[model samples]
Target: MNGLKAGLAELEALIAAPVLGGCNLLVCPPATLAAAFAARAAGTHVQVGGQDCHWQPSGAHTGDIAAEMFADLGASHIIVGHSERRTDHGETDAIVKAKAEAVARAGLTPILCIGETLAEREAGEALVLIERQLAGSVPEGLAALVIAYEPVWAIGTGLTPTVAQVAEVHAAIRAVVGPGVKILYGGSVKPSNAAELLAVPHVDGALVGGASLKAADFLGIAAGAA
Candidate 1:
């Protein structure tokens, strides 16, 4: 919540500066902060998004936020199948696919995340793992979805896969997702490595972690995406 507020304030300042024109920004904050951020971002170039959403549009699921609620709050996008959600909540591919469908039904774009762990990569199973995740996690007619590849072992670990490795995984993911899907790289994406990572084949953008908390780093990564 605090970070969202801080980012909104920073965005206002950046917009006021005439030199910072021609940039697009999207902020995905916690559910509690979505409405507030959406209202604050109204009429601004900055767009608001939800960090996660429930698989069902409306249900008795305890402590789960639905995608419709996020859309009602004016969220334009929703992050699904994040590494944290998969690791901490034990979410599977089927669950993520349902969530993606819910997001689409709610009229929001779903950012579908897919990746492999260190063990899988070490065993030469990264492509295999990603293929399964892509096939099982994404629904048919995926034009409204965005795919983010976040290697589980790299997130918050201060470690990242090599440029060649990233390119290979992204290429494999793109092949499976077809030509329309935008494949983004995530996991410890820092300003220092953003340039190289963004240059990789099939890498459309990044789902940054700790580095995204700062305006400078996030903007640097965004700029690299261009």
Candidate 2:
């Protein structure tokens, strides 16, 4: 939902000036800019992605973009079941699972997102809620995928959970999903706390949002991953 044509050049220059750390860098820009950004980031370690995709390969779905469409645009990954999608579009877990399967079928890694709201956390049902989402949204026997835990309340609010709290939830996700799946912590991730958050156990990386819109801030967060 962000980033303009001009912005892409600035970001590409920054990334090209110096290599990023070992962590994989991916950006899911608006669908309109997918191919352009993909071309812009080509020949670099950076990868381009899609914000979301339709479960179907192609149909008369009107405005909906298919998973294969994103794949054709040189996107290496696509995000599914983002909290905002669930909240705004009323997408159910079943829908997310179908979309993830589609993304995988399209030969792109699906970044499955799962998290709880503030009310659910306060009610002491955070773990229970996330566990249910994991079981429902994640497909069986899918060995390759990325999971991002973005608490609904924390996203874009400059709010973040404590390291222990983040570790606790991530550990829970790892417990249910088994090993091999990288779990990234989202929600207001910035340079200031990126290192500390990335250090948390089971916290494989970050699913940055707002901070990633800027080159310096995004690079700073990526530095923390190093």
Candidate 3:
């Protein structure tokens, strides 16, 4: 919903700059800009991705983009089960799993999102619920994948969990997904707290939101990954 061709030019230069900390960067722009951005990002460290995709390769599901379409657009990865989609579209873990499977079939990686709502966290069911979602949403035998832990309550709220809180959930996720999977911490992640949050055990990377819209902020966060 943000960024146009004009904005892409700025992003192109920033993303290509040397100060990006050598971290893996992926941009998931609106569908209209995916092809354009992917073309610009070629041969650079920045990879392009999609916000969402349908599980079925082709169907009458109008207004829904399929995994194959994302691959066709040169997207190396697609996000599934984001809290926004789960809450706004009523997507369940079963649906997320199917979408992940479709992404695998399309020869693209899937970044699966799993997190708890504020009420769930308050009720002390965060780990229990996240584990349930993991079991139901993650597909078996994916060559490459990423999992993002974004507490629904923290997203866009400018409120973040304590580092220990993030570590607790990440550790639980590690136990379930095993050692090889990469777990990301999302939810209001800004440069100020990026270093501390990234230092937490099992926190592989970030699933940045608003901060990613600005190259300086995004790079600052990447720099904190060290």
Candidate 4:
């Protein structure tokens, strides 16, 4: 929702960054740019992905993009149940589960996003809600997956949780998802606080937003992960 075709230049900048080993930089552009992004990122550490994906492979679901379509375009991953989608589209855990399964079927990794709103957090229901969403949304036997925890209130609000709070939630998430699953933090992530957030326990990566529009800032955050 935030990019124009000019966004390709950002991807190009990332592609030109030094190939630091073990650092995976994935960009999920709007469906409209999937082909071009994927094609450009081919053979590079910069991988292309999808912001959202439909559960079904092909259907009459107008304006919906499918996981298979993304896979066909060389997208290695797809985000399911992002907070915005949950709020704006009313996507449920069941719908996210179906989409995860669809992503696995297409040989792509599913990045399942689970988070709580400000009210839910203040009510002390954040962990409970996240656990419930994980149980309901994750399909059995996923070969590869990623979890993104984005506090709904913090997204684009320039406000973030304390490092301790992030650690607590991520630790709990780690216990449920086990050691293999990579958990990411996604709430106004930028270079300024990237190192602190990435250093938090159980945080394997970032589900970056606004800052990613600029390659220098995005790369700086990636550098923090190194």
Off by over 4 Å in 3: 19-22
TM-score of 3: 0.97
Worst 10 residues of 1 by lDDT: 14-23
Ranking by TM-score: 4, 2, 3, 1
Quantify all predictions' global Cα lDDT against the true fold.
0.84, 0.91, 0.91, 0.92
lDDT of 2 at 193: 96
* Candidate 4 TM-score, C-alpha based: 0.98
For model 4, name the residue pairs that clash: none
Instruction: Please estimate how well model 2 matches the true structure, expressed as its whole-model Cα lDDT.
Output: 0.91
Task: After superposing candidate 4 on the true structure, give the runs of residues whose Cα lies further than 4 Å from its correct spot.
Answer: none
| Candidate with the larger TM-score of 1 and 3 | 3
TM-score against truth, every candidate: 0.92, 0.97, 0.97, 0.98
- Candidate 1 lDDT tens digits, 32-94: 778887888787777889999887888799998999999998999999999888999999999
Off by over 4 Å in 2: none
Error of 3 at 44 (Å): 0.8
Report lDDT (Cα) of residue 167, candidate 4: 94
On a 0 to 100 scale, what is the lDDT of residue 58 in model 3? 97
Name model 1 segments beyond 4 Å from true. Answer: 1-8, 11-23
lDDT per residue for candidate 3 within 46-103, as digits (tens), equals 8999999999999999999999998987889999999999999999999999999999
